[model samples]
Target: MLDHLRHLLAQDPKLAKVGLTGGLDIWLFRNSLKILEWAGSARDSYNSGNTGLIQRQAVRILDYLDGTQYVQTENIPSDIQPILVDPKIARVALLEVSQSEEPPGYLKHIGNHLREIISSPNVNDSQKKLANEINLAINNVQSWYLGVHDDAAQLIHMSPQQLHQPGTMMTLNHMFKLANNAFVGETDPATNQVKEGVSQIHYEAQRLATFDIMACSNNETSRPCV
Candidate 1:
């Protein structure tokens, strides 16, 4: 899915200038690239029968999640907050985890067993203690996720109309500019192509303006306004 979206974004330079599609492309590229990398690494490991690398990939994702679970939204821009807590994004995150080739209610079943371990009379104090700790850890992960799906899933999946909100547009435009500056000298083929496309757009606009001025000078109509 990420690959397909990226392909579409790359296929059209004009989309990069439009806030709706461009903002999504920028957000996904900036944030979700690592997730895609981890999934790819896992696939390669599974293919080569190197289980160690696949285990490492899981560890990397958990570590990253642990680090970002307590993200400070206080410093985030007000306009960007709405996008963070959007319910649609949260649903997408849950859907991705739930449909991971596991049986229905897999995670829910795990949670239920944890509860039974903590409450059953046969369980010893140490066993219950471990269950309590695990339960707390899971709760911490859930709280950390909330409406902030990006912290975990790292994808911003929403409708174009949703992204076209005034505040959202403003925030995305700001993010796009920061990203544009950060990749100013990146040597990747795709990055270079994007830069070239932007340059071409600017050049064409200037050339058209110059032509308009020359035409105005040769015409008897109103003069070119500066």
Candidate 2:
């Protein structure tokens, strides 16, 4: 069922636009994962004669589907600085399946094709420049997609003291803002506020700098700040 829904959304942007507004896609994707994970638990409860457990789960599902679900955002480090984002992009970012299981390769395939074109010795200067620009754009989008998960994963392994440090907290907030821009298909202000079409290579660079600072602060000789 989850796979079918993902297929439909991937095939039809119009359908996704209508269905995924206001972070409904996030709630739906997460709840679908929960329901799948708990299916066995539900079955066991049914076999144990605790029918109320199934009934309660059904009620919760109904409530969530009807938009009564309350997500507590206070503790989520990545959500510390909330901003508007396109629902469709948000859904893509939170996709749980492996890359091979994704619907189809779009940006990556195009990027590879562009790289070949750019690298060909026969290509004209103008054509090579155009291809380079397109490749740069594709790379930024790919970076945005990867950075969200990578930053969140890093935060997950950090100690509470590390997470709450002044520099780390600032970096988290910056990352959150960058994510909002990525999700909404907006340019990063830090890189492109005055410039028209600068490449967005900010998030990963910021993340590395923050990690280096944190590591140095902890006196970890292995990864001293450069």
Question: Any runs in candidate 1 off by more than 4 Å, and if so which?
Answer: 1-107, 147-226
Clash totals for all models, in order? 0, 0
Instruction: Name the lDDT of candidate 1.
Output: 0.33
Model 1, position 160, has a per-residue lDDT of 33
lDDT of 1 by residue, 1-226 (tens): 2222232233323223332233222332333334335545544444465544444443333332222222232233232232233222222121123234222121232344557545665555655555555444334324322322332222123233433444443333333332232222123476553322122222221222121113444345555534
Best-matching candidate per lDDT: 2
Candidate 1: C-alpha RMSD to true structure equals 26.8
Q: Least accurate stretch of 10 residues (summed lDDT) in model 1?
A: 204-213
State which candidate has the highest TM-score.
2
For model 2 the local lDDT of residue 134 reads 54
